[model samples]
Target: MVAIPQRTKGIEVTRADDATTTEDFRRQRIAEAAQRARAEAEARRAAADAGNPPRPREINGRDGPEPVRYGDWEVGGLATDF
Candidate 1:
């Protein structure tokens, strides 16, 4: 006759321990990802506000150079909204 082994208390304890470890690891990974995302956002913001002078770029293939728009369009050196 085939015999089936009965579940032991030690097995349950080990399983519980593993579950706790997995949860902790998951939380740590999530926190790290959030931190990285925040850092990337800050870097993007800094680059955008780097104070570099705007250069004129052609808009819609217009014949003349269109002002390099930063925030608002500069028409005759005066800031105007589109």
Candidate 2:
């Protein structure tokens, strides 16, 4: 009669049988996500810079301040020059 061995935790498992291809799949997924993020950022930057410069706001009878746009974000009334 033959006895079968029981499997236990912390025991080393060997993959000397069928070949596994898990590592290749994981790397492909990470690369795809990075590419998508880069494309989106590029599009936002183009849109922000395409339009005419924003007009400056008029303060108490003085020339208005110009608003600054940075990649889909905007800041108004800034004293520092861009």
Candidate 3:
């Protein structure tokens, strides 16, 4: 029987004619091509967003002063009784 040779992970490999099927190799190639296409599309989107400025939001409610809280809790102590 004839033998087929394939290189994987920097190693030389050899398999018999029936050992590896054409469908297995085709699936691997299709998956790799899909990954490359997705990566390229993402790069294009990032470049476009960087060039555009951020838009401002509209406020429909009345504006008022907001309350601020500072350090009201004690440190290294629990409020719950055992």
Query: For residues 27-54, what per-residue lDDT tens digits would candidate 2 score against the true structure?
Result: 6777899899999999888888787587
* Best-first order by TM-score: 3, 1, 2
Who wins the lDDT comparison?
Answer: 1
User: Highest TM-score: which candidate?
Assistant: 3
lDDT of each: 0.62, 0.52, 0.59
lDDT of 3 by residue, 1-82 (tens): 4566766643445665533555567678889999999999999999999998886653663233321234324334643211
| Model 2 TM-score relative to the real fold | 0.39
- The deviation in Å at residue 7 for candidate 3 is 21
- For model 2, the stretches where C-alpha displacement exceeds 4 angstroms are 1-20, 52-82
Which stretch of 10 consecutive residues in model 2 shows the poorest summed lDDT? 10-19
Candidate 1 residue-wise lDDT, 34-78, digit = tens: 999999999998898886766677465533334354343565687
lDDT of 2: 0.52
